[model samples]
Target: MKMNRTLFLITLLSTFAMQGQDSLVSNIQEVTQVADTVKKVPQRYKVEGVAAVVGDYVVLDSDIDKGYLEFQQQGVSTEDITRCQLLGKLMEDKLYLHQAVQDSIVVGDAEINPEVDQLMQYLTAEIGSEEKLLAFYRKNTLPELRSELFEARKSLKLAGRMQAKVVENVEITPEEVREFFFAIPEDERPVFSAEVAVAQIVVEPEITKEAKQTAIDRLNEMRQDILENGVSFATKAGLYSEDGSKTRGGLIEGVKRNSQYVKEFKDQAFSLLEGEISEPFETQFGFHILKVDKIRGQEVDVRHILVYPEVPQSSIDAAREKIETVRKAIVDSTITFKNAAIQYSEEEDTRNNGGQLVNPVTYDTWFDLTKMDPELSAKVYNLKPGEVSKIFVERDRTGKASFKIYTVTDRKEEHPAEYVTDYERIKELALKEKQIRAIEDWQNKQIKETYVNVNEDYQECEFSSDWVKTSN
Candidate 1:
């Protein structure tokens, strides 16, 4: 009941660190006076100055300040948030983490270490250097910062897993979705944004045979050195691999047989023995050499190096001209856009579907205008349904050039939610509401069973969960 209201407020407004010395003094004095009046302030708070403790985890007052600082940095308003609400969120997080530990939810080093590396990389780039990042965070060394980040990330991962487990089996039927939609007041129904169904034809640059051979030769040399010279595979991967996983020595852990790896990559990974490296193999992304580390039941841990051939400018020009030819045919009515896409588009995933782009976030055919990529929005904005855009060169994350032409298949103007037309969105909302209820029920039950203690200053704060008043 109160959970939704409290969470909504929390989302809109979270606490900010005390801005002025006067404000900080006021907070300390208020809590201090509360402590003096009660005459029952916990000794741990006096010593460690923790705000609250839930199960095995302690929420420090400084942690709440840091939370506020993060919210402030993200430009969230903290004007009216109370320390009590901040502490409540920390307590909820701790509760989830504590229960995750009790329930034996495991987060491995392989998962956490990469995240730490990525965070460090991002912060270093943002702060200008690793030394500046260390100084900004007041950390003396990289390992210290990494250790702290590791614990934080592990706790976050555990909390997320625990929350997900709470509603893992929640399901909503069509009847439930229908009922949920009509139950909303007519005027209170959400306004659906303008959305468009878009399709595109992509022509990828064909790699020259010489360039492809060069990439394969490089991998073969690296693999040979790794085997014959007793050189570290990780070292070669870190030095030469073009993939993002290079920072972690190209390590990918807990990969399953059903993982979303390309078929060639997965087949090579599954066929290798521990400590055995594979020969150079080709995938759509490019050539790779992988070494299996260990096998645990259905999961395998492996390290790989990826290398993509350099695309010649001639190939780029050829791709552009090819797409241009296709676009001309479509515009002149020689061939339909869908037929051209099916026959000529090189983007394999969408080619079979007539190059219709699915919204990755919603897994739907429609993309909301406001949230669509700016470049894509600009291209499709003026085009009415059935109009195709001029050929545009696009680059992949690796900066490989391609040419694409887009067609706007359908468009919807902003309107109040209609049950018939917005059934999928309605179903998503219904499922989310059900999951929230399930989480609330879980919290209510867990609070009674878990060890919880709040400072006297926060005992009076109204919490959505029964954090302050759990009884035997």
Candidate 2:
């Protein structure tokens, strides 16, 4: 994504707006102490001076340091760009953030709370716990940190809206696409290789029998403690659950009723009443004893201790057999492909959707033979519509391999770009460019009126827009 500080500021503001005023101020004071509290940081990434200030907000020395460190981590070379490009991008954020407050954009509790939770989760993963994160940020607690970030979040969101407003309705015509295509240099014209869309019948690896037994034994031990020793399941989840949802006492958010989780995990979890414990059952993650915490209508919250079994050849052999059975069932007239998916597929994201791959570019439902990755598209190009290919190992964007079956439903090789093929996308792109121009124009005007003071240290630097007054 394009990096803009204006968006960052709005988001930061909105995030804090949800948090009460007094607490939010306290959080800012604490955040300012971030430099003071940094007893230890990554050795390679030393602090850099604060490059610029956007209005009242002081850009911190650590901000530039962290930015440099991340760029280095990502292997981005700064050899090509002059200091002008860097300053322009960095300082443009201040302009956007200032506009954000004037526009009165606010992000409320419903919006910020989830972000706070995600932030907490990330911090917990980074620093070991919420307490450590608080210490690192020089804050008293999570609530304090969240409150300070609320305003920033708002500032960021408003900046985005302003950007959208700048060119939201701009359109690119057929001529524009051709113009863009022709604008590419002959040497730089990228090879538009054939991409394919493939559907999947995924199967997870099976855990060892010994692993299952061990998990059962451990869960039984935990269950015994819960029953006899008065230990709470939530506490057990915090201490023992291996799933990412462990910290929230086994809470899983946004689960769909139509979706499928591991059958073993689901069957036992769904069967148990509230506050009841499930006997150990085996799933892809391994042997788990489930503690059913709450049921909200169609959803249930369960904390489970998953003890993964070391994979034995026999375990793979077993899992392969079970998945192949479903594959066979699909091949035969025994079950409709959709029915089999709904009944037997463990891949939750695509199970109810009938394992159909949706196009990210177009919201169109049909899988195209041409737009897929070279490796996948190569395999699926030969298959006819409605015919299912055999189980193939394909890596997702993350490079995780799982069992898959591709069914080609659509094949389009060439066409004059129509509204269906490219109009909306082209229009959206054009509109955004227009908006950016509009925003830049508006920003230029704003700078003329608004008091902008840059330290004389940057007088030689040619920013995107020149600052009005110089500060010592």
lDDT of each residue in 1-472, candidate 2, tens digit only: 2334333333333333334232221222223233433332232322555556666555544554444433342234434434434455545656666666677655444344445544455556546777777876679965587676555556555665665554455566677666665565767644333334446567755544576677678888988999899998778877887654454565554333453465666777678898898877776555678777788787776677765545566655665777788878777868766666667666897788777666543445543444333465666778766677777665332223456665665554544334445544445444444445566677677777565655454567655565624333
Question: What CA RMSD would you report for each candidate?
Answer: 9.4, 10.7
Alpha-carbon local distance difference test for all models: 0.77, 0.57
Tell me the spans in candidate 2 whose CA falls farther than 4 Å from its real position. 1-48, 68-77, 101-162, 165-194, 204-237, 245-319, 325-354, 360-362, 365-402, 407-425, 446-451, 468-472
**What CA RMSD would candidate 1 show?**
9.4
Candidate 1 lDDT, 383-404, residue by residue in tens: 8998999888887645688888
Error of 1 at 11 (Å): 7.7
Scored by TM-score, the top model is 1
Model 1 poorest 10 in a row by lDDT: 16-25
Model 1 pairs in collision: none
Number of the top candidate by lDDT? 1
